[model samples]
Target: MAKRRKMNYASPSTNKIPVIFSIAVILIGLLVVMSSLKKFTHTPDQGAIEENVQMKNEEFINRLVPVAKELHQAHGILPSIIIGQAILESDWGSSELSAKYNNLFGIKSFSPNDDSIKLKTKEFKDGKWIEINANFKVYASWEDCMRDHTLLFVNGVDWDPYLYQGVLLASDYKTAANALQAAGYATDPDYASKIISVIEKNELYQYDK
Candidate 1:
């Protein structure tokens, strides 16, 4: 092969056996690194606590979501409006009546001629809950109240959306809330403020966006 090329080679400090040992050492190091990462990431208690909080929030959201979604579907009103209304009316489930009666909106109805149905209600007279017999429309369930709310918007002859759209075209949440109040949605002077409070406090508007 013409003057054959000379090849020179030198053995490392260790032979193939040492190479095997080095490979084993590398594998062990890699395993240790992986294990450390696993340990760092394994926060079972934290995960469980976070999950519980999420579940509670989900339950609260579920309780309020139907009202918001219903109004959104029927009137194109932001679900936030409904959520806010519930909060203001129900006091975030802290109201004594809300806990017992589930009447979040405090809607009223009584036979004009007869005092057949009377219910206990709270009034802010001198800042106290007064057990007075008030005329209120009782429902079979809370769901009925939300349904009725939507229907009022659609069925009210003079105050229906068809009639009021032009009036509320520039409607912000505050304007719409005030418009509803002016249309006799509620008697309370602070009605709109209450709805706005609930929506903002719970961040209920997130449901829409």
Candidate 2:
């Protein structure tokens, strides 16, 4: 009976091998796609982070420019120095002391009756740094804080009314920065240099005009 056609049927296991191979290939492709997506969605690069920081700094400077100019016109405090100190002391008004209490200049309050808050701060002393708790002035707004800061230079300490007169007399940022350091506005020995660097780097002198 015409020799029964030799039948060669594939085994279930053999069929499963191709299916498994296809599934594995598909899984590999999916893995590759997921990896690519992860890379695409990764966090911002260092350059992006720096750009963001620069933008924020610019915003801080811009926000202070008008007020600083006004104060400069009225008080003779150089806008460059005012803006630079704010940048350095307040960290562009991002510091907890400045942001929360509007104490942009780190102005301390010596009297118990003053509107103030006690906070820990670092002071440069004996050629080193020390942490100390101090009372810092509190203000109702940034503008008010700025006005108070100007007033400090204008009014000076009770013991020395002309302590910061050198700053007001300064014709340039460098002189004003040095005057601030000479007047002991900050305990940091490098305070003047730091302020000058900030002013120059940001072209804060332009605001002085």
Candidate 3:
């Protein structure tokens, strides 16, 4: 019989090389998958968060424009002023006083029998901010709150019937905003500036027309 050629077989250690290589490839694949998952689960960046906030604010303003324009037509109050005060006082309708109770203008209730809720509010006093609990008016709806707001400007308080008449007489939002501060609509010294800033920043004057 002819002698058979010697068969060359892989050594066990050599065989393990392929197995090790396969394991390393699988591990690399797993690492890649984990990295992809990490990227997918990341939270929104500051810019994205800010964009969402801006969008929500725009939505709030748009929703109020129709009613504000109507109020302006019925009363002489500037639409820009109404919308600006709504945005500032209610925090775009996110404040608990406005969101739950529909008291958009922070109108207070002096009578215990009135429909109201007690809440903490900040007041500017003695050149410092102080928190106090007070009774805030409640309304059936946002529309009612807005109507009451306009009536307050038109009718004024018990002490003075023409208190906010200056606001209604203002030709522009700036003057109206200042008139609000002058009439003591809010305790904050910079209330007028804040309203003006909100109006200008959002181009709320467009609604005046």
How far residue 149's Cα lies from its native spot in candidate 3, in Å, is 0.5
Residue-level lDDT tens digits of model 3 in 1-209:
99999999999999999999999999999999999999879789999999999999989888888888898999988989988999999999999998999988899998888899999999999999999999999999888888889999999999999999999999999999999999999999999999999999999999887
In order, candidate lDDTs are 0.65, 0.93, 0.93
What TM-score number comes out for model 1? 0.55
Candidate 2 scores a C-alpha RMSD against the true structure in Å of: 4.1
lDDT of 3: 0.93
lDDT of 3 at 37: 97
As for TM-score, the candidate ahead, 1 or 3, is 3
For each candidate in turn, the TM-score is 0.55, 0.84, 0.82
Tens-digit lDDT track of model 1 for 44-99: 79889989877765675687797667667667666676667766776665665556
On residues 54-171, what C-alpha lDDT tens digit does candidate 2 reach at each position?
9999998888888999999998999999889988999989999999999889999998888999999999999999999999999898888888899999999999999999999899
Local lDDT at 10 for model 1 = 60
Colliding residue pairs in candidate 2? none
TM-score of 3: 0.82
- Give the CA lDDT, 0 to 100, for residue 46 in model 3: 100
Could you tell which candidate, 2 or 3, scores higher by TM-score? 2
In terms of lDDT, the best-performing candidate is 3
